[model samples]
Target: MNQQPVEGFSKLSKQRKIDWLIKEYLSDDRSYEQILQQYWNGDAILQKLHEEFSENTISNFYMPYGIAPNFLIDGKLLALPMAVEESSVVAAASKAAKFWIDKGGFKTTIINTKKLGHTHFIINVEPHKLQHFFNFKLKKRLFEATEEITKNMRNRGGGILNIRLIDKTADLENYFQLKASFDTVDSMGANFINSCLEQFGKTLTEEVAKDETFTPEEKDSLQIVMNILSNFTPDCIVRAEVSCKIEDLKDDSGISNEEFATKFKRAVTIAEIEPFRATTHNKGIMNGVDAVVIATGNDFRATEACAHAYAAKDGKYTSLTHCTIDGGVFRFWIDLPISVGVVGGLTNLHPLVKFSLALLGKPSAQELMSILAVSGLAQNFAAIRSLVTTGIQKGHMKMHLLNILNQLGATEEEKNHFVTYFKDKTVTHHEVISQFNSLRAQ
Candidate 1:
């Protein structure tokens, strides 16, 4: 469809944008206007606050916020809040949490907590000279120059940790990188790290211009390309694990414990060896990770990017998790580079986010990383257990039945009837419509 740009779309009032959208796209359908209003907050103050969250606010989008309790991580029981619209994700995590609670639950360890940023520049100078320029004296001077920016972060026990010069001339002529590491403490630190990088870029340019060691060509060639924090934080990593004896792996799937363990391990092996399978495997893990991350008002996009990148760090895409049965003990675990924050962003501003953090006992950044990793591990375990046993559709379809019923506009009575009707039957959209039609006919 051909469309014309609406000038000053963002400057329009909230209602004005809605009116424009309805006129242009809805063809003057008044029903959508009501639908949009239906999701608005009942309180005027809350609704106004929500409108300010973004530009051109039309309506509030909502996802089911659920809690998965009995997560005994590091001897602490926690009820993790998860915001997701997927049918079976919360159910799967809850089931895994209960199953592992008796099996010593989950153990988590923080491997590293340093975030990364880069300052890319081009300098037509010898590699030795470039290396010498980033020497101890200059590095100290650079850190000192950013003291004004780093002062607050340092007071909070987080600041610029290290600055190193990286030679990338092999890829592009005269290309070099000024890579930095930071301890952001409790915050996600995107803005802080970027601010520091910009300051560093300015300092580098000024310092090079003043140095008598560089010719005009070398000084002029020092052009900063960009300064930004990297979402691929390999150094910010955590590990979560759950282990139990192979003989203890019993369930209603009718598979023997030993056979189940063997099959589970095999499924993980396939994900490890096959990129196609690994992608979906990792996505299942993210279902749990992202839910908790979003619930706590953290950046799920950055967390997901870092995780997928870490999965491919071995030069081939593979699962973010691993499983093994050794000495009659079955163990499933994941080592992932997950960067999340307990403070900053929407954690304090959003009401639901604050509630979710409070529900988590207000963990530190490191503790939040552990909780998120465990959530992913739990979700992966539940998914693989289903995949190797009764197949994923049985339980998923059962949970998805409500969505189908709701879509058909089934009455509460009819929905109640079908809920029991499809308990042991496979659910399909066609079957649901057929049943709804049959019920209506009667």
Candidate 2:
């Protein structure tokens, strides 16, 4: 491998960068160049827009944008778009949607929609003195100072909800946090919350400088570390659940409904107590969550980080969802904190996102939260049901059969024949390749 660095790489034209990359690293491979070109949108304008989505854009990387229809969420049918490369995710979600639709659908409720931001600072002043200064008068003044920044949000009935002082001397010397909560309404409010916090930080610095109760040394010790919004939004939570009679859970797998529910509940309990299981357990939940989040043009990374942080909020990693059978009814639900927005970022910029929102009837932020949470819950149920019944691979590997066939370069006839052949038999990569090779020999 050559270790030489290419100077002015970012300044190179798009084609130049592509040329340089191919010549430098790919040994001038035209096939790889063609592969990149093959995925570019035929429309030049759209392709350019995609290229500009980020810097040094050589080409577009794509995931299959699929639709999982028949989601009966909150008494409405929705077709959710999922952007994922995995084989069985969309299939499993679709199965879950269809199963739950006949079981009275998924019910969801938004517990709250308040996002959080903080202005972290260190102060050498007495704790009591700082608390007294953060009283009603100072708090009101702080809110008033950010009025310009929050005016539009305020007019829309969303703005700074509360501000409080948190003492952290036990954790660090002279450390304190000005925790602020906001109602961003339909937008994720990252920029809005950050702007407000920065303004608050400036106001706090000025106010502390002028406070007669604070000596010169104390004023100098008051230092702002950072001001930013928190993705771990515990207050912005939603609950989504599905319930049915245990008898209604009967399936073609020959497992009794009672036994099915018991195994499912036990599976959830193991995730709750075991850290290793909980990591993968929550990842399965996010496969559903991140897909919907990406489809709707929300920040999937932020949502993922927040959801996992919420999972470990109890100081031990655990499941984000729970299953229970009560009074002859089998219920599964997830109460997780997910911060998402429907009005900003890529939601407004991407064409597919607009379509995805329209497919969901253009839900508000709270409604989007409910729908996302339900997607996770439904995915979990489908997974647990599969695990407890015929085992995970029966369905997963079946869904994966197409990928194997395609990879083996099976023609349409071979694919159709082998798809039917593998329907009743187990499928593996080696088996598919061997069968394909044998068929080709014939």
Candidate 3:
């Protein structure tokens, strides 16, 4: 394939970049530019703000920002803001929330709030000497060096909690790490943690050079590789759970309450033991998680990486959610490990992010964590409930009806007709198109 490269693309103006794209790759079709411009913010200042959010911005891409109401978490009712492109996610969450609310609503607990970062380096030294030095001399220096960067965080009752020197010479000769734990409180703290880690690297090099206990060659042997914060925050966890008597599980499924509970547990067990099933099961869970995460302007990519890693932490891929039936009560829950922020980054700049935070009642980071976990749990319940009864497509395809209708170029009157026709019928792309074409013939 021949690839086209642009010269000084980032330096190009918005209009010029679109022109270049049309002339070079879009067959010089001006309609493409019009389509891109259609999504751009009408306000000049807001459009400029969006452009600077990323580099080489040609135009804006839009996702439907939806709200799922009736979420009762820890005795608090919340209407979650979700930004997603996929169909049926918000509807599923809302339906699940309403179902659980009738029983007693969802409950959540904050297990911990500790995030992690590391300073990776290699130093030629005996293990004992490095350990003794880190304990007696270098450890205090690391804290003192990062005081400036962590001052505001500490004032907020969150900051660097602990640091230690870890030797990994057995795995790789002279490879070591300074593993640190943090309490970032309300912010995702990537920048804050990375800033402190970089300072630690700087302090480690500077202090080692000044110490007379180390020989010149030993000092020179110290090489700092990098300082970074890990997205996989296993220790920072929140648990969301819902429980109800089996009798309450009785619904329109036509199955006995006991039978519904049994099948739901069995479906979860399949996902737990089967890798092929677990992948799709977890994707359904993230349909809820990533939506809320994106709506709040947090990093969905990081959240996904961490959640999947945690799922496979036991050396096999499995489900993030769990379920059990005991003493005639059915319980379902998920202990999700994720770090999010109610402030900073895009929360401070993006208008919708700010609006989302407010819509969520301006929750603290801990509250937000619980909300996200509950979103995932609620979505999973809705999925399993559907799967064990009417099947996944019944609801998903119905929600997807509009997309099919639009693709077939149905008018508003036809749309209303088809929607009513498909209300009690199966909705498939082929069937929808076929029915519309027959209507056109009539």
Write the residue-wise lDDT of candidate 2 on 242-277 in tens digits: 899998986767878888889889999999999999
List candidate 2 stretches off by more than 4 Å.
none
Model 2's alpha-carbon lDDT is: 0.90
lDDT of 3 by residue, 138-226 (tens): 99999999999999999999999999899899999999999999999899999999999999999999989999999999999999999
Q: How would you encode candidate 1's per-residue C-alpha lDDT over 330-437 as one tens digit per residue? A: 999999898888888888888999999899899999999999999999999999999999999888988999999988888899989999999889888889889889
Best by lDDT: 3
The local lDDT score (0 to 100) that residue 80 gets in candidate 1 is 94
Q: After superposition, how far is residue 243 of candidate 3 from its true place, in Å?
A: 0.2
Model 2: worst 10 consecutive residues (lDDT sum): 135-144
Once fitted onto the true fold, the runs of candidate 1 whose alpha carbons sit more than 4 angstroms away are none
TM-score of 1: 0.97
Q: Rank the candidates by lDDT, best first.
A: 3, 1, 2
- How do all models score by TM-score? 0.97, 0.97, 0.97
For model 3, the superposed segments whose C-alpha errors exceed 4 Å read 1-4
Model 1 RMSD, rounded to 1 decimal: 1.3
